[model samples]
Target: MSKEIRKFCHGAAVAAMVGLTALSASAEVSLNVATVDAAGTLRNLAGNRLHTLLREQDAGVQVRHIEGPVLGNAAQVRDQVAEGSVDIIGTDIAWAAPYSNFLKATSFSFVFRDQEHLAGVLDSAMMAELIDEIAAEQGVRILGAAVLPSRAFFTKVTPQRAADFEGLKIRSPQLDNWLESYKAIGANPTPVNWNEVFLALQTGLVDGAHGLPVDVQPNNWHKAAPNVTDLEDMFGVHVWMINETRWSGMSSADQATLVAAIDEVDAWMTATAEAESLSTIASLLDQGGGVFITHNAAKREAVAALAGADKVVAFPEDEREAMRNKALAAGKALEGQATWWAPGVLDELQSVR
Candidate 1:
């Protein structure tokens, strides 16, 4: 929704909620939510689902999902929430990492074994304590986190082996850990804004883009970079953050209601992400846009024996491990630089089953 419409609706809600609260003090609570993705995408769906679930649990809770670029990018809207102008924001964990060392640790590659492992760590009491720390220090609290599919390269030229990626410019966000990890894998990691990635790929500003199928398919980046090399290295986590002050001022009952709604939506995202990714690839293939590449030795050899095998080659598993190690090392190194980092947090995460 546009900011003008949101303001009008919020103003209307205030008067209606005032009457409801007069009847019962805890009768209503209103939340102004922000998200960077456009309406109807998975990210937006999660926010809209939260609104539905919240209203079902408590009829008087008001939620306005302000879709972007109505507000700005993820970083800009996150500032809005921290400043208390917006109640909640849906953003990537990586975008929020600069504010919280614990979040920075989670943003690195190979930190979790897989989707189930990531989910377990996020749902644990340890993570809850870390989030509380963010609220206490950074003014924003992560309510819940959900996984997206594993990320890899969507390249103009299919990389037949790990060596093929060497010295090639790969587009990624300008983040220390991500840049360092890609460097370890031998790619000359290039920083590019997400919105500008299509132009970057089309103009050969970067030889390939790094992201998931869902991310590339919607933007038709696959049309520019038709080869998808599924290194299956790391997954993306979408986090819901709320302003700590706003949360603290809310009635305990209202806080519980919002948390319950987020919990359900997190579950839904985790359950559906994998299927959505597969469906995305199927559609990409049907549209003559994607050529899936795998790293399994047998599959690689089998595809290589075919007529156009170069389009379906593999990235060495050893290279993927090297990237993972570099990311873990980078995450560990943060403890010395950031005073708020807990020494054993990385160990604790790895220890989770």
Candidate 2:
């Protein structure tokens, strides 16, 4: 979503949203929601679904889903929401780092047992309130849950052994979660912007790529880095936000109704994305794009061992320990509330806890 020049639909955006500053009780509550992904993308579909759910909250609630660069890039939308110009927007959790310490803890290696484990922690009421309390200061409130699913690695050359990734340049975001993971695997981590990822891979600036399958599919990264050896190093979660002023204007009954609907939409979106992501790999191969490199039990063990043995280089040892402890405690607390977990995911959660 961040890779190219923005084409904002200025007039179209303004047309879609009905401003809500001073509305009569006879009028509906208007939500001006924005997303950076184009229509048909997972997050966009999720946002659209969110719109449908919000309207169902009450006859008084109405939603407008303005997508793409119509609201500027994701960062601009964040600012607009803070200033109360936009009512809602969706973005990655990286944006929440400064808002919550628990979010900072998400970067630690092995913090999540698996995809569902990661979702469980993020959807828990504790984390939800923590994010809301922190972000409320900025005039934005965390609305609900969003899972971008887990991220994987792909390369131009296949790695037969785990250590084969050593010294290779792997493209990732500049966050410690990504940089330190690749460094632990012995790769030279290259921080690259989202839009420039295709260029880096095609030009060989980076030998391997890291991102969710949904992310790389539309960007056509599979064509450049064709050897996909799955290594789910971390969870890719998104943060849903709404302007605090808008939320505050609503009555208590209205707020409760909207929150419940948002939570339901979040669960549906996460499940849909998970199913679609699994199908993306097959389509990539059908299109003559990449071979799936299977990492057998031994190779998988080797990868786990490497990450487990990875030293705390990006963060101070004491801070790393604190993050891990907080992360685990958060996960443990969410175990019971993970009703949306896929089959057998709870068992995995048990092992992690």
Model 1, range 1-353, lDDT digits (tens) per residue? 22211111011011211212222336577899887775556777788888778777665566888865587777788889999988899877787777654556555656777777776655543454455556778898777677777776788777766577788898878777677557756788999877788899999999998876776666677888887777656677888888988777776556656666776787787677676765565555555455667665654454344424443556667766766676567666665564335665666667768
- Off-target runs (Cα >4 Å) in candidate 2 are 1-26, 55-58, 70-72, 107-109, 123-125, 174-177, 294-352
The prediction achieving the highest lDDT against the true structure is 1
- lDDT string, candidate 2, 170-206, tens digits: 8866666456555655678898776678889999999
Superposed Cα deviation of residue 122, candidate 2 (Å): 2.9
Residue pairs in collision within model 2 = 3-195
Q: Highest TM-score among the candidates is held by which one?
A: 1
RMSD of each: 8.7, 12.2
The lDDT values for all models are 0.68, 0.59
How much is the lDDT of residue 44 in candidate 1? 77
